[model samples]
Target: MEKYLEIIKNSYSSYWNYLKNSVFMELNWENYFYGLIIISLIVWGLEAIFPWRKNQSLFRKDFWLDTFYMFFNFFLLNLIVLIALSNSASELFNDVLGIVGLSIKNFQLLEINKLPFFTRIFIFFIVVDFVQWWTHRLLHRVEFLWNFHKVHHSVKQMGFAAHLRYHWMEPVVYNSLKYIPLAIIGGFSAKDIAFVHFFNITIGHLNHANINWDYGGLKYIFNNPKMHIWHHSRELPKERKYGVNFGITLSIWDYIFKTNYIPHSGRDIELGFEGDENFPKGFIQQEMYPLGRKD
Candidate 1:
């Protein structure tokens, strides 16, 4: 119990220090703190120069709201709640495994650290994205999960920052689901796969940006704004009522699984789910929305 408390304490202190360095710009070139800002700027700049929805305002509706969602989801809640909970949960899970005479290390399918650096990054990227792809599908297909996911689908207008306008519960779901598969294929540190993680964030931002670029045939391999905008379309096909285009960093999965759908450029499609007119506009209201307690 004391060790558990120490872990909790250290999580808060360590992540707090990270948040301080991030906010103060004291991080190295690869820090996600500055990367978030720089990526948003670069994508927003692209949208401004060559927007798919040309008439959409420079500051689109709910633009600032989505911007706040970016930081809040990325840092604030993690510092205050998620880090401690996840660290403690990991410890408990490891203890449970130890009781079974099996450690996480026992399940290792590959030593990622021993692979070529680029191979390691690529493997981690594909596996992480594939796991998230299924998780994304579940977020739509399952009724209960969809409630938490509605905060993201409630976006009425799409922009770069809108990439991160998801419920706080989402990372809990994503990371929890990612933990086992990643741990099984373990032996790599966050620093080892930082480039892939950064690339994933960049792709996510660009996917939600108001730009239409598919990179010709490369669209088959990578998720692009053109294909992803349809994922936000209010009117899905009758057969695909739950959702479509469930890809994360890669479109190959969607293409392979037949979830990809883009009959035309989705510049003017109505965004958001059914009955979205009543969706809350304020951040607190939206955060509370999934709990059936909009304030």
Candidate 2:
């Protein structure tokens, strides 16, 4: 019986490994960059062609700061993830460290095999977003962590790279917290983890973009650029729209929390922080600003 169980576990491991390799290999670095370029081009095209912020241009200091974040996060931060995974009991550790796989494990309690792949993906993203919503809220409310997250809010302009402007430590803590639950439940495959990262990063970039693209009614299903821009707006009461579009993929949680804010009649919104006027322009300054202010 012990040998049989071992065989089953090995088979499962092999199947998962095959899936990971297949998925990861199919993701071309160039193609991913191309997609980002396309997203950026759209934002730029809208601004140039339709031109919302007449005085605002993409060449501002914030734009480059965001770009730096994008480069480091995609290349350096990802390298760190790979290194972390190389450690012994990496999967188990990831599970215990955060809630990454909790939903998947719990799903097993039901007839999860009957569910479709897209459904599973939906559930995973939703669960992570729910975790993130509260986590993000806490960071802002709590004094210490707020220093780390403030870097994200420092951006005055929206763009594909704004998502990457977040401090590295923020993800270390968030991803670690998430991985614990994921590992415990054995709910997530390696591929699932990668997909979540990719999908969230992509959406995050879109949300930060200044473009006027809206997914229409589908905006209810997912937080689009327009809705997210409102969150970043500097206007009074509008700036407090912070907690509404917390979901990385879906806006369901925002609706549940009564924090949903979607403007009708197309009211013009200002983007960026009004209260904190001392926001720095340099990359190093932004990262260190939180720590400097911590004490």
Candidate 3:
């Protein structure tokens, strides 16, 4: 009994220390909160001034629900799942690669840290974005995955916060596969990762915001709100087998894959999946929705 008690005590102590060091010690809550606030203000301001759907209110349908989704996804789900999965996957891959006598250190395709700062960011951005694009296409193609991804498509009104309105399992799917190529290309510095993250956040916001800007010919390179709006269209275009415009950052992938579809104007476009009106509206219900419940 004494030995068992000692073991339990040590386990608890180790867990507590890990929680303290890994979470509290590294987490910069101030920066996170301040950054969120600043970005929200800027995006919200842009949406209000240069509105897409005219006369649309800020407090449109499902606005608060999307806000809840944004917080839940970023703060709770992503923080836990991404950190755990990434660390575990890294360790697993390292061990597996070591057994084959090819380690990331020796067999790395690109020494990203050795590159210039902007170049490193560009490379990381393109690589990660390609991964996201592929994962997003998978989410739409696979029926089981679509059930979870439907939570995102159920939105009738698109706002800045709507970008993060996705099922909790989404980050698990995306982040798990995203880092593999990066790992093969060599490890990135913390700064490079941050740079890519910043661009992702900005682009994600703009893509989902209630703004109408295509960036003209640049739309073929970078995904704009107009391009992404079609992605949420209820009816798939005649030419596409699955959904079109699967790109997250770059539309080049969609064009190459022949999934690109952009109408002259998105003004008449009605968003949301078919029969989504029957879907739940509250955050909790939406979270529970992908479980195949009739309710």
Q: Which candidate number maximizes TM-score?
A: 1
TM-score of each: 0.96, 0.71, 0.86
Residues 153-207, model 1: lDDT tens digits:
9988889888899988888899899989988898776676678878888999999
List the lowest-lDDT window of 10 residues for candidate 2: 80-89
| Separate clash counts for every candidate | 0, 17, 0
Q: Which candidate ranks first by lDDT, i.e. highest?
A: 1
Q: Give Cα-based local distance difference scores for all models.
A: 0.88, 0.62, 0.78
What tens-digit string does per-residue lDDT give for candidate 3 at 1-295? Answer: 4544454555555444544554444545324444555687798899889988877788777888888777777666634455555565676777788998977787677877788888888888888999999999999988888888999999788788889899988888898787678777866786677667767777888888888687788989988899998899988755564688998888899999888888668756789887887988888788888886543
* Residue 200's lDDT in candidate 2: 73
Cα lDDT over the full model 1: 0.88
lDDT by residue (tens digit), candidate 2, 1-295: 4544454566556544544554466545323444455656665565566544456676654777677787676555545442343333354443554666453344434443356767766667776887787777777667788777777877766666787778877876676566544444444555565667667766776666655667788877777777776666566364553444565656667777877776652225655665558777677777778777736
Error of 2 at 203 (Å): 2.2
Ranking by TM-score: 1, 3, 2
lDDT of 1 at 277: 90
Q: Candidate 3 — number of clashing residue pairs?
A: 0
